[model samples]
Target: MLNHIIGRLSLGGLLARAVSAAALLGAFGGAASAVTVPILVADVDSGRVIYSQAPTDPWFPASITKLMTTYVALDLVRQGRASMDTLITISPNAAAEPPSKMGFKPGTQLTLGNALKIIMVKSANDVAFAIGESLGGSIDNFAAMMNDSARRIGMRDSRWTNANGLPDPQQWTSARDMAILARALIRDFPDDHDLFSISAIQFGGAVIPNHNGLLGRYPGTDGMKTGFICSGGFNVVATATRGGRRIVAIVMGQPSARERDVKTADLFDYGFAQDGGNGPGLDALPGSSSAAPPDMRPYVCGGKKVPAIDEGPGAVSASATTAAQLVGGAAASSPSLALAAFSSPGMRARTLPPRAPLQPVAVWIGRSPAEGQQILAQQAAEAQAAAANVRAARLEAAKARREAVLAKRQAVQAAAKEAAAQKQAAKAAAKASGGVPRSASAYTSSESASMPEAKPGKGLTKAKDAAKPAAHKPVAAKPVAKPVAAKPAPKPAKKAAAKSDE
Candidate 1:
């Protein structure tokens, strides 16, 4: 079921006249200035516009730029240049984008399919940038591809400068251009329609819901995208099917997400009420007079009271009184609904019900499911190894400190022992030299020979005399002289002594 109808929408001429600018301004909080937002509704099958309001006016695309990003990626898949499983690495440039991001670190990788799901559901800027880099080798290159595709697809009023649509003065698109692009995406990739309808995506422990409030809130609503910035307010490109007929609705520059959602629902009600009407194709829409897109910062973000941004967890639902207060007092609580308020003669602000429970689709990082597991396991193992190395280093440092302490202790003991030995040597030298003084350096020579040595019983004065030899008298020489003369007498005496001995 593919329809390549480019664009032709019947502008609700009577309907436009009935919904006066004053009425619209009252419904939009009765601000001082009445901002004219771009809106268009067209049948997907016949490519005929059911209702339109300044659809050709240029406006900031905001995050809806991801639709073009997605188309470019899907086109790559169609041309066989890449596949869904192609791995996209989050470079430093991607990781450094502003919030509404995935916070993936530089070098973190995920399959192109997972990345697409994240950007669609989470409106993640970082992931979108990474996808651009992966597909086109750089963001500038990817933007070139986007412009080339837009021109080729008959989108007359759109320019893309960045992948994530962060505030760039150069980037803008009109309701007509966005609708045509949406039609191309739907017609070109019938099998990939589910990509736009994802309710939420489960990434790791986090479950991020899609920002498009009408997905579950509105009955026939199926797939689409929503975007917001201070300068752009809120924008949405939504599609729905009813009674075997599908239609696309584009709303841009709403004051808040609540108005954006309510207006879209009202447009859907009007679109389904009509059969394909006669009108010019999307290409025939007149270009805007202004060269630059309107800056809605004053209306959207000025003053003390700022409107609810689109990045919140859920769509804002207000009671009738609260809604009246928001839109500068319109109506009281009643049984009437806000869905059909815009198309009716009088518009009233109403509250939306709380969103349905999220049905999360699982997304993981890597080239494949098995590869993701392997990468996780490898990371765990590396973390463990790093911890072990830290422990080892600590132990090594402690051991070195203990060794130094022990070496210091040993040195102290050795010094004490050497000191004791020296002291003993000094004492011995003092005793031998009669208590003569000496230093540690005097061990090489001793004065014991010149000094007196004290004995245990004798004093130091008698020690010299005790150490001297005894003197011999002069009788030693007389004994030798008398020996010769006494020899003759001794011989006679010896003879007598011998006779006596015999």
Candidate 2:
């Protein structure tokens, strides 16, 4: 009964529902089922495949295409044709790429290291194009170099049509082929693999988080690429280390981000377990599954279509509407309509029509004084408003500061006046007491004067009281001397004395 239930559901069907449930619930806890999606897990140290399923089955690579771009770049560095610090200039073509891009304006410059970081973190399409243009002078020429490099590196079943993999039906790759490329990158540029391990990259006030979830979630997972497109689904080439063994796992056609990560986690768990003691050794795993027979079945969705991958200079013409405007307008109506349109063969063909010729607009130069005057007046009004705001702020600040300063000054002056009054009262009291005002010059000096020394029996009552015992011991009571009368005036006093004698 269990076998019947398991056999009733295809691996693809089970995965679709599992991915849906995981996305909604944020976890997966159902019965374990074998993952039938094409994958390749290999040991990076020995260039050995540990486990693989449909490793050679062809599938769209999406932005995983950037791995080849990096491979080509590193090859240039290895050949001494370029340095890792070289600066690449953004061109108009590069600036025109859709987002999930570093929206660097044309003529903007970034170092090779920064460009690679943008590619690894943001998966920036513009940076990829700029690198290609800088390296090969054009993306077309750069793609040729990429394919040649791939062939040289023994990626026998791989092809590249663009530097930043925007959807082209022709941009197909195999899991085994991607694993081979990943091995080359690690082996040839061990120094730069850290670029892939970066979790977040900041540029131009925009901080792009890496799409590869393994960087933070998986213990030993380090470097590689993740990719997605409507047709390609989600894919990743992930590297992890456990014990002394390093392995790379490639998963393609995952239904969603969570599924992709969970599936990758399972692969890592299995690979590590095998490394510990369970399964076959790395070398014993199948070397190369058969290459997918060429996709000879003609595309039947649209009227008999040419198989030529759209390789022209431009695939889509700039409409009267910008990409954002078109997408927004479509989304406002049906929400899911835009996505549905992209999936429809007819809409894709129409929307991505061949590039149109550049149309020139007539230029009218020279303005009348009145027109110029009007513009000047508008600018002057704006400037006046700004200046007025600045003046108002300055005035408010100055007023507050002035009030504070005034309060501080008033407090200081009141303190000074109080001190002066106290000093004046002290001087007046000393003068009233008939004491020779002790050291009047010292009192007037800014330095506070010490109290004068008290004389014996002088005005310091506290000292006098304290010295009462001493006061009694002092026996010098000098008699008060009255002024002597004049010899008396003369005769009157003499006559009085003669009478008394008779």
Candidate 3:
């Protein structure tokens, strides 16, 4: 039956050795005597517990707090209270947190979606703090909301003190409770579940590889988270799917990362075996071991350190004990120092009223100072020439504009005068022909005019005949004058020739 169960598990991926409870104890060696390492595996589809060893035992949550932070932020997006693209600014307090951070400067902004990616991939503590401050106004307020969400999700043994699980004894959760949270996260945020399965995330030039080993090694593994601290050792809540069967496993307090993977693989094998109807094979082992109790010594005593809570803007300083005295002391001391610091930067001398003018120092030279003044005169002359050129260019442009205007005016006057002369000549011709002058007639001349005594049809014919003769009359007159002048010129030349011959 055990072989059949192991075979069923091997159908999805190769089967590895199932380390017995005794082997688990030996692997822990002496460490198991002092710590309670709780391990739980469940069929996520049915929420049925397949195997359990101290499933309800509480342990430090470490950086696992980011999972809850992401859950709450995604909830806000789901509820329409915020959007994934909403920009979040890094506050001064967020910027001041230690690294394993996105390292955004105080005023740098990132979209809510990218910020969540940094928290999941980089485990960026500063981004978590900024998200808390942006969403709930403070980390404490955000943690309170986280606890509220835990209660809503039936995470009875979980409490969150900070967004990024940096250490707090007060901050703790059980394997069973973390499994419940993981289930809730997967069920509520199915779209973003792929973010957890990512093996590495690169932002800017920094590459943060996911700490969860199951993403790479486990064939069907898709999502969940990994966490660690000095006290918590290492913990992982892993989920895997095979042939439509999904399971969630929470392993806490594994001595080393290798043991954690081995134990998780064993849990998967056992889970696959049971679901495949393999008969129970490990009945000889005790149901519960008489292992030494968990060492709560680190958290129980006064050695547990309470983290400093950031006081937001306008918050009264935690060290301000006496309100009136503090206010009075600050008011009294601030102005004098401010004045002293202000006055020390040569400002006091600058602010003083002007002093009486000082007398000029005279120096004797071998030559008069006027000897050196020639270069200055030459520079002045060159400057004057440049100024004159600039003025000339301006004057030329102005002259061009004036000339264009005058030319346009002259064209208008010439057209008007030509129209007037044409009109007067048309009027005189109409009077001679005994016809009323018309506006159209102003454009006609005597050559276009017809005689009133002529027949209406033949009037144009007679006008053309009259115009032909008038055109030839100028040539006829030139010939007649030439003959008259020729006759007189021969008489004068003959008289002059006779006188010259005598």
Candidate 4:
């Protein structure tokens, strides 16, 4: 690492010295301590740079890198390599990006247009990754495309290692590079000019506001973006138009979002007031070492802690719609509510102006319209299958409930039969203890047929005792006394006389 810097210093020493000289010359206007960031205010139409402060110094881009990512996608669309409706499925790598993200789960589907909206409005990291993977097949391959595109456009101070602009030492960009990219984005894609101007997006019933503050507060604010990270500080690439003139402002490495917005807004104000186009060309801006700048953690997250920032209305931001309008390069843009508020004395605006809302069209996985339809159909079929599975589960649950109910009823019935048998046994015991003839004659056949259960356990025991009739007959054979006929005694006496004669 030491050798690399030394070698660059040996080879690029003259350039560094020249940059220092230029920076010293420019430092007369703004105090060095007052503005730690690299700032630039340029006239977009005349190719004029109205302000410059370490514009070429290396700085981390943070979320603003999405601009280049968006640019690459627009180029693909122009070349017919992709379309705004191109479906970008969230891959695991894309879904794994840290917060300041949409948190879309893996395999989540969205069209390129919607993805771009999420990136611009939500400053979503995951969506940016999905966009990269969709266009370049992988984030690494897409980063290669970004570098190639940057070199082609002469963004010498910029390089991209990841799409979401998460912390990476190798991934850095400069104010000048970001300005060039912002201008190119505004220039090349006219139709998408509306994208940057979008103030907010309604997602899942919640409004995800744009990070660009200038959009609704500054009268001329139209479109552009803001970014931040502990290493990057608060950064923004903003544009605004007043009357026929338009300007782009890039502010990087401020201590807070409020300071970044107000300072940049004040710079645009200063630039628009300039009399003539007198500054170096965009490509001719002075730059120092190509290596990453010093870590800003101490300044941002260390001793003097940078406050948590949310870049929307009530946040420290200039008007972004006006910056977007600057992207449109539309000469006819009028001063909006942001301009009105800026014109008002001591008016600290709380929210952005309302947007002319439009729903984004769907993008699905497909090579063509027919293929996209096919994919949609497959998704529908899968959804239907899932519904069927749910229905089947509910049905099974109901069937189980019904079976339980029937089992309960059968148990109750069996219990009732056993209870009835017990009650009958108690009644038979009471009857057997009461008076009743033991002789079989007392129970006539007709009476026995009707009163088969007169004797306790007599009827049912017939079948039971058949197995051991002799044992049962002797156990309950209690003979009962009966009245005898008088003729029986006379007969007995006559029989006794006959027996004596014999």
lDDT of 4 by residue, 26-64 (tens): 121244331235767788876677767678888888888
Residue 263's lDDT in candidate 4: 50
Q: Give the per-residue Cα lDDT of candidate 4 at 24.
A: 30
After superposition, candidate 3 runs with Cα above 4 Å error? 1-34, 276-502
Between which residue pairs do clashes occur in model 1?
8-49, 9-49, 10-49
Q: Locate the minimum summed-lDDT window of 10 residues in model 1.
A: 1-10
Best TM-score among the predictions, by candidate number = 1
Which candidate comes out best when scored by lDDT?
Answer: 1
> Clash totals for all models, in order?
3, 0, 0, 26
lDDT of 3 at 389: 97
Candidates' lDDT values, in order? 0.72, 0.61, 0.59, 0.66
Question: What does the lDDT read for residue 376 in candidate 3?
Answer: 41
Ranking by TM-score: 1, 4, 2, 3
Candidate 2 structure quality by residue, lDDT tens digits, 264-312: 6555655564443333433344444434322221211123342222111
TM-score of each: 0.65, 0.51, 0.50, 0.59
> Which 10 consecutive residues of model 4 have the lowest summed lDDT?
3-12
Q: Name the lDDT of candidate 3.
A: 0.59
* Cα shift from native, residue 396, model 3 (Å): 59
Model 4: residues >4 Å from true position, as ranges? 1-35, 303-502
